[model samples]
Target: MNSPADSGAHRPTPVAVVTGSDSGIGRATAVRLAADGMDIGITWHTDEDGARRTAEEVRAHGRRAAVRHMDLTELPDAADAVDRLAQELGRIDVLVNNAGTGTATPFLDMEYATVRGVLDVDLIGPFLCGQLAARRMIRQGGGGRIVNVTSVHEHQPRVGAAPYCAAKGGLGLLTQVMALELAEHGITVNAVAPGEIATPMTGQEDEDVTSTSRPGVPLGRPGDAREVASVIAFLASEDASYVTGASWVVDGGMLRMGPQAGSHLESDAWRRP
Candidate 1:
C-alpha cells in the first residue's frame, strides 16, 4: 500500500484492475501492485470473504482497493464489469485477466455445457476484458499494461483437460494479436504462464510439490502464488515498457521436459489401477 504522497514527488499513481483476485495468484498480484503504488480494483466470483481479505491486504500496502463480484462466464457482461471497475477506480492503468474456469473431463465424454463454460470464462471472457480495458486506456490518452494469466497447457496438451487446453491455447494467440494491435497505441499486452503453482486449483501444498524431486524441473520446486505475482508486478510497471506479446513461463523448468515421458513399466498403461 504505497501511498501516492509517499511514492515520490513526480508521477501520478497508477490504477489496476485484477480479475478473479479473491485468492491464489490473482490475490497476490493485487497485493504486489498495491505495494508498487497502484490502486486496485478486485473482482471475485463466489468468495466475498476472500475478496474482502484481498482488499484489506491491498489497503494495508497503502493503496486504495475496490471489490466487485462478477461471474466471468457471462460473456455478454464481462466487458461491462471491466468498464464499471475502471469508472469506479478512476483510470485503469493495468488490467490483469486472471479469471478462468476448467474441469477434468475426457474429451470424448465432455458435455457441451461444460466445454462452453470453460471457453466462455477462459478465452471469451478475457477477450471482452481486453477490449474494454484497451478502449479505456486509449481514451485516457496514456499507455497501459494488460497481463493475461495463461497456463502451461497453452503450449502443451494435458490429459482430461481438453477444453481447458483449448481455451488457454486460444488465449495465448489472442494475447499476441492484442499486443500487435495495441502496441502502436502505447499499450502492451503480455501473458504469464504458470505451471504447478501451489494454489487451491492444484490441491497440493507448496512443500508437497517442492519436496517431490521431479527429474525434469531444474528448480526442483513448485511455484508460489507470490512468485507469479512478482512477475506480473514487473510486467505491469514502467520497467516492462518494451516487452509485449510474450508468454513468460514460470514453471520451474517443468515445461522444458516436453511431454511427461517415463520408463515406468505398467501392464496396462492409461488405465486406473
Candidate 2:
C-alpha cells in the first residue's frame, strides 16, 4: 500500500469510515482507500471475521484500521455508530455508506415489514450516517467526502426488487440534496450506482469475470468490485474536488438499455422469475 497522503504540517492524516465493508465492494473500497493513504474505520452487519479481515488488510496496506459491528436495521441511532468510529479513529475524512439489503419477492408479494426493513437498511440508515458525517466534517473545519453506494436500480425498475429500487432511487436524490446543503461546508456528497458486480452480494465471489462470457452485458462481462472501488477512490481523492452531487454509473453500459430492452424480447421469458 502507498504511504499516507501528505497534507502538510498542520493537517491531520486522512481517515475514512466504510460501512458494510466486510466483503464485496465494501471490502475492496476499504482496502483501496487504505492503499491511497487513509486510515480506515470498517463496519459489518453479521460478518465479524470478514470485518476483521478487512481491518487487517487495511493495516497491511500501512494504514491504521478500526473495526466495529453495525446493523442498520437494529440500531436505534445509526449515527451513534459513526460517532464512536470517528472518535476511535481520531477524525473522519470520508464516509462511504455501502451497507444495504434487498428483498427479491415481487412488489405484491412483499410484506410491509420486509419493505420497511429494506428501507431502513438502504435509505434511512445512509441518511443518518451521511448527516452525522457531514456534521463532523463541518466541525472539523475542513471538507470531507461522503459516497453513497446506491445500485443501478436507482435509475431503472426491476421486476423482483421493489423496495431495493425505491430505496436506491431515494438515495440518489438524497445525495444531491446533501451535496447542495453541505457544499458551503466543503463537504462533497455523491452516489455510485453499480450494475452486476462480481461480489459476494451477487454470488460471484469465486467466479473469474476475465474468462467468463456474458453476451447479455454490453461489456460482455460482470464488473469487478475493485473497479467500483477505483471510482470511489477517485471521488475521495483531491482530484474530484470540483465534482459533486453526481451519480457515477459503473455498469459497463448495461444502463443504456431501458425502453429498448423490451423490444428485443423473443417470448414470455421476461415474465418468468
Candidate 3:
C-alpha cells in the first residue's frame, strides 16, 4: 500500500477531472487546481468553447489540460466518461462533481421528469463519477479526493426549489457515505456548499441577489466563483487528507440565518465597505 507520507515515493502528477467546467465554479476550480500544480481534465455539457477556454487557462499555469464533452444528465454514462478521462489524461487523482441544474417551479407544479432530471444530474451523476474515480484511485495504489459541489439549500429548504433542494440534500449525505466507504481505500470524499455565487446559473448576471439586507444571510454580497473554487481546491489538496465526510459551507454564514422571528443580525467583513 502506498502511503501519502512517503516523500521518496514517485508522486505521479495529479490529474483532476471537473465536470461542468464550461463555466461558473467548476471552471474556476479546474483552473485553480491547475495553478496549484495539478493537471486538469475539464468536462462540459454544451459549451465546448468555454471548456477550451478553461483548458487554455490551465495551460497558462504550465499544467497539462484535456477537455471532454459530457452530459451529466446521462447518469449511466458517467462511468465511461471517467474511464475516458483517466485513459486520456493519464489518471484522475481528484474528481469534482459540479455539474447540476436548478429549477424554480413549485413542488405541486414540478413534473416527474423535472424531478428526475434534477436528481439524475445532481445526485446520481456524482455517485457514478465518484465510484469510477475511487476505483481508479485504488488501482493506482494511491488515495484520491472527491468534492461534490452542493448548495446552502442542502441544509435549508426554499420556496419553489423543491427538486433542487432535494437533490442537493441527498448529495450532502452521499458525500459522507462515500467518505466512509472509500476510507479504507485511502480516498476522501467531501462537499462544498456554496451560497449565492455570481454566475450565469444564479441569475446574478441579470439581477443582483447579493443584498445583505436579504434576511438571514450575513454576507451582503454574492460570493465570487473563485471563492468557492478556493475551497474546492483546498479539499482536493493533500493538506485536506484528514478531512473527509464533511460538508464545508462556503456560504458566507447564510445557512445560519433563522426566520425573522428568530433572526440574529450579524455583520460580515466581506460585506463591510
Candidate 4:
C-alpha cells in the first residue's frame, strides 16, 4: 500500500503536453522531448492510432506517456484535456500548442462558419490551452515552457490562406503578450514557426528526409519534422530559460524570398484561391 508517487520505480520527471501529436511535427516533438528525459502527454484530434503510436514511442525512450483526445475547435474541451493530462502526470512542465487548421477558400466566397472554424482551431484554441497551462504552472510553483507552433506565414501571407495567415499572425502577437505577462510566474512563452516540412500536412507523408528537394527554398530541400522538433526541444529545455517572446523560424529561408529584390511581378497570383 504505497502512495502513487512512491510506487514509481524512478523519481518524477517533467511532463509535456503536445497537441495534434498523432503525427507530423507534433509526434516528432513529443518523441524528441521524451528523449530529453521528459514524460509526454500526447494528444490527437482525429487519429487515435497515431496518438497511441506516439505515446508508445515516448515510452520507448523510458519516459511516461499518456494519451488524450483534443480538438482545438472545441476550446473548452481542449482546456479540459490539458487539465486531465496534468493531473494524470502529476504536473505539466511544458505545453506545445500545435493543434491548428487552415483553409484555401477565397475570402469573399467563405462562409462565416468556415472562417470561424479556422480561427477557433488556430487562434482561440491555443489561447485557451496557453491560459490553462500557465495557470497550472503558476500553481505548481516552478517555471514552465509553452511553445506555440506557428507557421512561416505568421510573418508572411499567401493567397488562398487568408484565414490561416490571419490566425497565425494573431497567435504570433498573442505569444508575445503571454510572454510578457507570464515572465514573473516563471513561465516562458515562445513560438516555433516552421516552413515547408515533409509531413502529412504537406502531403509528403512517408517522404524520405534525405531525398527531398524544394527549389524555391534557399536550403534546396524541405525541412524534416525532427529538425523542427529539435528547435522546440531547445526552446523547452532549461537552456532557453532566458529566452521568451521569441519566434524561432525553422524555415530554410523561405520568408527571405519574399517578393525578391527588384523583380516586382505584380500579378494577381497571390490570390490563387
Q: Which candidate is the best by TM-score?
A: 2
**Cα RMSD to the true fold for all candidates:** 4.7, 4.1, 4.3, 5.8
At residue 128, what lDDT does model 3 achieve? 91
**Per-residue lDDT of candidate 4, residues 1-273 (tens digit):** 111233255535788999889999999999999888888898898999999999989999988999988887776776689889999998888999998788878878988888988999899999998988899889877778999999988988877788999999999999999999999988899999998888998888768866865556666677899999999999998788899999999987778868231123334344255
Candidate 3 global TM-score: 0.88
Task: Go through the candidates in order and give each one's C-alpha lDDT.
Answer: 0.84, 0.86, 0.82, 0.85
lDDT tens digits by residue: candidate 2, 115-183: 999999999999999888888888887788999999889999888799999999999999999999999
Stronger candidate by TM-score (1 vs 3): 1
Q: What is the TM-score of each candidate against the true structure?
A: 0.90, 0.92, 0.88, 0.90
Ranking by TM-score: 2, 4, 1, 3
Clashing residue pair totals per candidate (backbone < 3 A): 3, 0, 1, 0
Q: List the residue pairs that clash in candidate 4.
A: none
Instruction: Write candidate 1's Cα lDDT for 170-189 as tens digits.
Output: 99999999999999889999
Stretches off by above 4 angstroms in model 4 are: 1-11, 259-273
